[model samples]
Target: MHEDEWGEPGGGAPSEEHRDRHELSPHQGSGEQEIEASLRPRKLDDFVGQPRVREQLQLVLHGALGRGEQPDHVLFAGPPGLGKTSLAMILASELSASIRVTSGPALERPGDLAAMLSNLAPGDVLFIDEIHRMARPAEEMLYLAMEDYRVDVVVGKGPGATSIPLDIAPFTLVGATTRSGSLTGPLRDRFGFTAHMEFYDSSELSEVIRRSARILGVDLREDGAEEISRRCRGTPRIANRLLRRVRDYAEVRSDGAVTREVARAALEVYDVDELGLDRLDRAVLGALARFFNGGPVGISTLAVAVGEEQTTIEEVCEPYLVRVGMLARTPRGRVATAAAWRHLGLVPPEHAVGAGTGVVVDTEPSLFEE
Candidate 1:
């Protein structure tokens, strides 16, 4: 898997024409690039939310630094934009170690991994993002290097082959993946600890927004931050992005002060509704209701129906809907529950029921029923 395979084209390549219509900007980095260049947390205490994970990571780094030993291999799993990469950098900073960053898809050949591993200083942190997408041969080479601090490079053809075992520095390997379940069992088991990042609550998001607003030197009223937080889709990255957009809107349209009204107006103008559903989100629901008859539709079909990628629907959009109690994943496929229909101002059919199959559809008024 190449970096392009992950759905983001590299270089200055122009976005495809079809994608241009949606106004979806290309992802520049793992969301860490912006943070690193601008707002990265310098210390663990500065990182907001996920207190338990932060504490555990702090202990790991402290113990390793105290003993002058390499920290154990660690895994961080979560949805995108949740600070996995940031945590990896923080680990390196805490250990007072040099850090090298790469992604699974970027290490295409075994030689690439070997080159990177061999150059690492003792106690350094080599952070691999999207670890599940690493090539098999490269992944195999990593196992030995991580376990024994050495790698065997085989040169030449079978008859004249020479195997050379080269020693590597005692560096810590930190792997981050959005889909940990897709990782091989051996790879998954090698990690000493795994941290699963969860969606931030509104309170946590508000804290993140407030912290970011301060860093960006934006004048944010308490109500303004709260309003922005409510529409952030429970992700720190989204919160930061929304903050930047709202700041721009405020700068041009208002007195350069971020207030509740300004935030609300900006978000509305950007097509993010009061409930935080964007145009694409409403399109997905509308397609389900109008075309699939409030389906139990397959993800692929739904994706095609809404003109978005399946992964986008599953990983990004569906999670929020599921979190808000509007969508349900059934054995058959995905179904719009009563809340979803009601959210769209549609009435559930007489036969429609909740995921439990016990609630009667008639109990809820449908816009279509009358």
Candidate 2:
């Protein structure tokens, strides 16, 4: 479904002005928590798309069950909101194993991870979200735990220390990260299998919308779901969010039925245009077009130009822009592609003289040289 729709009250019941006011706010750390709570997939079957990953995971779980052993460590890498956490939970459920969930940062010291490992029962799953952020000491402990089911804890500091070898129960470790490349090679290689998740296709997102709608008990027409899915940026989370908004639109504005017209109206009211570009998206493009003269601008410069955070520009906006071919990354920085210029109804200078164009111009000589 549409990115703007999720967690909205069903039916277009909210006043246009109210909706507009809400849409104008930033979508950073605030709204996402609510959206995530509302839309997280509760079951494996409900997790849309990533069929290959699903198949492989099912086999792993099944084999583990058949052999009465803990499944091997699994590493899931992808952009955010791709169901890595949900899949981890499902794996734990399938194995009927207790899951201890924590982020990399939570386990600050080797002792912290060692304690957690020591407490785990056999076949339990330890899910580490944002594993790339784990401290070096904790990561070192994890390597031994994963490889040999043991942790060596130093009893005291400095030269007086003696190492204590503590055995831990055989447990499965599931790691999730947005940037797998940042993980050390040793850490990366420790996982028995790595699953790289990709964005959902429109069809997959539509199914996600339909499924969510069914669960939420909203009457969503097929075309309406499809329309929302098309603008969901190939993300299941966005699709679920869009469904909620469209449902609100349908209920408040018209009959409590989500139709294509209702979906379009809801998205328009939310400042989500036809190309799935929200207000922030358009603002980024506008900044690149107007300020930088179709930008070969650095990310920080672009963020400053747009009055948005650099991380927001780089993570939330830039990836989609680059994916849709509206932006390109160059050795120098981010450059607005021709498509970006056209999308903003602007034209690049005919002879903009980009770096490495090999065109030379006369320059003034220094007085000392003369």
Candidate 3:
């Protein structure tokens, strides 16, 4: 049997080392992947949030089952930590089919993708995460496989190579991407159905935390669940991660009961604020408000001020900041809103973008917009 990405044997239980490592830090490092997998809902009904997507997907899967055929290629696009990967697994489970998991980065060559396609059995589910990042050649090869269930296998070198058309087993392709816009139009169009995952609301995340608490055997009070949910940044993955951290603190610092007080104390120690703004998040806000004077500053300048990579500033910090009305993107550059100043306990300058209204009017496209 082949090894999974975590080095665990495929189709088998995780190794003892994985268990021990998970015990050590249930929410940190690569071990978190294993824990998250365990926490994922095996059935679609058990999955939290994105009700529209769930309803749409149920019909597709049921219709395909009635026809006794594999469902069409499905695409899941949204921000990370919203159960894309989990949904892919659930699709396989619903069909009672085997699933093979790989990421776009893993399929960098046409041959690499060809090998994966050739190995799939009929009705198998091939899940490719971060599909937008797949190599150009691999992506082109996939177009043919997705439409015709055939791949051109070239033998020998370059000009002397012979292109052999190999018919592969018909399988369902499930693609997940955080940046669907980066995907080619042809690739996007090929997907028979697309599910856009949304950020979990407070109530949904509280339910998620409760479910996870039961699974982890944590003595989490309702208030504790609510507290953790509020600070989880609207993502189930983050909710589970924070719950594990809170559990650790409860076991060590108290009688192991996670109440509101305990959760707050634990989060305070970990530097997560009321709005779920962590160290980096606050740092970005502080820099924007204090250093750049509620800036229309370029991302490079802001990144330098915060000593972070531009990509980190753009992808990680900017999205949430923009979402919560603390920042804005414009033709000029990034601008901190009036809320950012207030959050940092500073007064916004009169020249600030949203200073007059005290509300950030985002002219640029929102990160949460579908």
Candidate 4:
């Protein structure tokens, strides 16, 4: 087999030790690419959730089109699988402009970016995913292009170098980044519009599931869809994926229909619990609960215990855990809550601060009485 980006084997299961199931599908750009493309909501009208983003983007695009001017550079900042790429595609569609898809990592050098920028036709949309990862030189080149729609090409060596100013067609740059904080001030300042995508709620994710099921010809019951949505960790992509697996279970094990029981069973088989805790997620909580004893353990220590990258743990696992109140981050370190202990089938310590007196998860708190 050929070498991968990490200089490892390319044709098999990934060698990256801590790649969770959530990170596998869409993040890696492998198995779910085609399926995701099919399920993508083309127009803003067809899109679900992110009401504020949808409304603001509509106004921006309409205003630009009304004035017969190209739309300004737009930036989308959020976690993975939050429909940033889909929104970019939708932007191009609304403008009736062709889109050129590239990522920051793909644009390694000044010339690489210059080539793409110089060739763009006026009003075309250039989508750069993971814009924060772009090289310094490339980012510098982008500043001029975004402002002046021109690129300075330097030919020859040293003092003999001749700089040729090339006028590029005015194009819209649509950038998407998970780490907006990592972006330089100059780059962040370049985007005229920034859409901060939020996580989809259970209702929105349920709708996404039902719509996807209809498109994919999967017979999913309402309860089944709800089950998947609740356990999808507020992501449409995850909901769609769980539905596909549940559909397979339905076809192979029982009748060709996904019911609540079927959905539960299918998710259980894959280690996705009631609270949408996938394998890696559970591992993090389990470690915090059982191994570290509801720890104020460091993130790096936890990552080592779980065989994952510290960044992966911070970016992917910590957000959801914190959101659900399973884990708490203190100045000292990360600590598991009583809820986390109960989820992993462990009892919270009686002496644990903030855990309450004999506090039982899933049971309502009582003021008094035996």
The candidate that achieves the highest lDDT relative to the unseen native structure: 3
Ten-residue segment with the worst summed lDDT in candidate 4?
1-10
Candidate 2, 1-370: lDDT as tens digits = 2133222111221211122233425655456455555565656676678999998888887887799777889999987656777788778887888999888867789888988999999888999987988899999889999999999999988999999999999999999987899999999999988999998888888888887787678999998988898897777766776677778888888999988888999999977777788888888888877887765667788888878777767767878888898777765566666677777777655423332345422233334321
TM-scores for every predicted model: 0.86, 0.83, 0.88, 0.88
Top candidate (TM-score)? 3
Worst 10 residues of 1 by lDDT: 1-10
The CA lDDT of each predicted structure is 0.77, 0.76, 0.82, 0.81
* Candidate 3 lDDT tens digits, 1-370: 0111112211112211121233335445455566656687899999888899999999999999999887999999987677788889899999999999998878889999999999999999999987888899999999999999999999999789899999999999999987899999999999999999898899999998888889889999999999988987787777777788899999999999999999999999989888988888899889878887776677888889889777777767777788899988886678888788888888887767668956553455444431
Q: 1-370, model 4: which lDDT tens digit per residue? A: 0101101111122222235334454556554455667788889999889999999999999999999998889999986667888899899999999999888888889999999988898899999988988989999999999999999988999999998999999999999987799999999998999999998999999898888889889998999988888997787666776778788888999898898999999989978899988888899988888787787777889999999878778867888889898988866678888788877887778644357886432323234311
Instruction: Give the TM-score comparing model 1 with the true structure, all chains together.
Output: 0.86
Off by over 4 Å in 1: 1-36, 355-370
What C-alpha root-mean-square deviation, in Å, does candidate 4 show against the real structure? 7.5
Candidate 1, residues 20-94: lDDT per residue as tens digits? 223224574554345434665767898888898998988887887789778899899987667787788778888
Residue 8: error of model 4 in Å?
23
Q: Please give the lDDT score for candidate 2.
A: 0.76
- Runs in model 4 with CA error above 4 Å? 1-32, 351-353, 357-370
